[model samples]
Target: MFVMGHNQLPPHLKKFRRLVYISPVITILSLSLLVWTYSSDMTFQFITRYYHATSDPQTPVQFTLPLHRGPGQMGPEEQKLSLMAVNGTKTVLVAAYQEHRTGQKEVRIIAVVLRSETVAYRCLLRCQEQLRISEGVSTTHSDHFGFAYGTADIMCPLPLGCETASHVTVISAASDSNDTQIQEFLEVKNQKVQSDSFPYNFVVCLSTMFDFTNVLQLVQSLEMLQLLGVNRVVIYKTSNSPETQRILDYYIYKGFVEVIPWSLSKFVNVSRGWLPEHGPGDLHYLGQIPALNDCLYRYMYQSRYVALQDMDELILPQSVNSWLELVPLLEMKYGEDKCYMFENNVFPNTVSLPPPTSQTLPPPSCCPGWENVSGVNILAHLYQEPIITETHYTNFKIIVNPRAVFSTSVHGLLSSLIDCSWVDRNIARMYHTRASRQTELTEDELIYDGRLLSYSTKLIPNVNAVFRESGLLPEGSIQ
Candidate 1:
């Protein structure tokens, strides 16, 4: 039965047997090849390019050492290749080994490395290109190049000109490479940005040139303001009109002022209606008036506060010590959010008689303290109230609460669209009668000027009569 079964068993069965025998051996051999590729000390010492047999023109052949074996000799039978990373840089290791009677002996290993030589070459090209650009020799797109090797630093100092070609390009190229082992480098960047700290608070900008002789006196008047503290006091000129330009130049030369020329003639037009032949018949041209409408517009629209005044009207000391000392005291009495007016009492443009042989009843000193002193109210006397005569040259002292004030006119307005009870504080006073000997006026003339509609000189007989009538003083100085 066994002998007859050989041919009858059939061709298909024989083929199946052959297949089973070959498949396992093929698999095992394939595995062995892989193992050898990984573990054997088979070095690909250098890379060289070779074209297929049918190339027309031969291309340049570049050779690079891909691996190096340490000095050792061994038989090929037991060599095993392995993979390794040196200094975090990936490399392939090919090991050599020998078979001893005991087992196997490792001889040496060769490391196959792919370095950044290409990068270095490209870097050289970039440097050359940069030189070309700097020299205006040629415009080329090949200005960027990158090369990296063996765990190089990210902040690599390029050899001068290489990075000058295009640092961003080089950085980008380095970023694109898969070799994460390379170090990244940064270039010196030049950019400036301003911080947001300045220009927050309100400002009172005084753009005038100070007259040297009278500047201290004028500043003293400004310094006497018991209201908000002065922000910036800029003096650009000194003296009256004839010497005004020269004084301005002097301040500019001394670096104490910024001169801005404004024509007094231009303002004459607005003043034609608002001002008399002299300045304001009631007050010195303070609060910018109508002349500096542009400055007023900017201040009203752009700035937080607007304080326009000239140099004479000063807030005199009441019971308080200095201007700085008076602000809080006044604020306490009249709520911190309020504006005030200090009525000026002095008459301007009066000349002294020659050599006062009899001693001109030492002109009535402009005084602040009087009887009946209260917050926001004081029965103070004035030589000439701007309210009456056409010569209303009396300056108005004002303290504007930034939050409550809007655009100013002949009078001030409130930002809040409602009317509130207005309180006056007499604790803050203004003395407006400091004048040169060149300017003086009799008490009778001051109190009872003929031009006044209500209180006229013709209506009153003398100083004694007026003082007695007003019940402010006794009849001692009156003749």
Candidate 2:
């Protein structure tokens, strides 16, 4: 070995050479190690948004390490911990860290749950190495599985069904408390949805058909819809039938229904496609039938569900007595994004008449039992001077998701996006009282009537000419 004294060393360069080579290597090595450790152990999280399908409420995201004890082997002095969420589904990602009881060296493990698109439920745990020194011999230890437990439970949407599994892709990390990589597990690539549509709890639009003329039955049906938790009702009257007007007014007075005047004839001019034109004498059908479509178009834009029908038709109850009871069952069985379809059954003679046209009235205590009497009650009662028979009865009705309804017609139309199911038959019916006292009309009344003017106009073009020539609107009221 050769030894040199400080005096023999090169005074100008020795110190600089030593400093440049050693210090730079040390600094570079320390930085490289720090970068590797940070890249390995650092984790991230993000905040996301969700919406309620049926209601307008939005849930807030709360983050914290849960207080539950983790499952697995643990040291006598060490306490294990895990995380959980409540109210809504939660996503959790965990990283492990260890510290020596002596020198206090630190080690960390980074983890990520790879699956989380819009909504998800899952947990991730990362294993970390622990270091311990005994008798001057250094020993390193690593856990096979991270020292944590507890899992995420994901909440799925309505009409949920199993599908083919796809690989979970981890996305960019969110720098929050979740400490997991956010990813999209489910994707709707080309979902086509209608825009600018009205959403309502339920919508029922009434169209008057000159059948049975049961004003009382109409009021009861309106009340029943209100009791069923329907928030709004639109009565589309084509004919200015005094009795029908009275029934609508009764509901309006009670703050239950809204009456909007519409003529079927003007509808024909404004609506061209899917509407068939009527000729001279057949104009009655235009006012009575096509009025459904016209009124629905005006009112259904803001409703979530819609039912269109004549005054005689009513939605009866089967599984549940009222709509209030049925909504929850529906939410549980079909989820928030579902539609219900009701089949038509005719219940004749549920109405009792010479009924007043307008007024608020209660539906019968029980569904009418047409056990024995038949032969069209309206005709039987009106034919006799005493009017012995009753005419108050329910006919038929259809239930549907208003949002899923596409076109309005006499029968109506529902879109295919909805999951359709049948309602119990005994609960509701469509009573056809057309063959009774309603079939007859005086030529003058048909020609000069203002009551049926709107329906006549929508269904019958130039109906104003007939009414005007007949001296109905007098020239002053005519446009």
How many backbone clashes does every candidate have?
A: 32, 36
All-Cα superposition RMSD per candidate:
41.7, 31.0
- Among these predictions, the greatest TM-score belongs to 2
Candidate 1, residue 48: Cα displacement in angstroms equals 75
Model 1 stretches astray by more than 4 angstroms: 1-229, 234-259, 263-273, 276-306, 347-395, 414-425, 433-441, 444-479
In model 1, which range of ten residues has the least summed lDDT?
A: 135-144
lDDT by residue for model 1 (53-86), tens: 4333333212121212232221122111122332
Worst 10 residues of 2 by lDDT: 131-140
Give me the displacement of residue 53 in model 2, in angstroms. 37
Question: Residue 267 lDDT in model 2?
Answer: 21
Candidate 2 local lDDT, 1-479, one digit each (tens): 12343356585656765767777456657766665554321312111122224334332112222222333222122212222121132222121222112232222112211123233223222212211111111111121122111111121211112121112111222324243444322221112223355555667776643322454345444544555577667664334444344344444533456655433333222222122232232123423333343334334445656666655554545556556676566567555645554554322242333322342332222213221111232221211111113322222355665444433334534223455555544543333333334334332222111111112223222322322332323444544
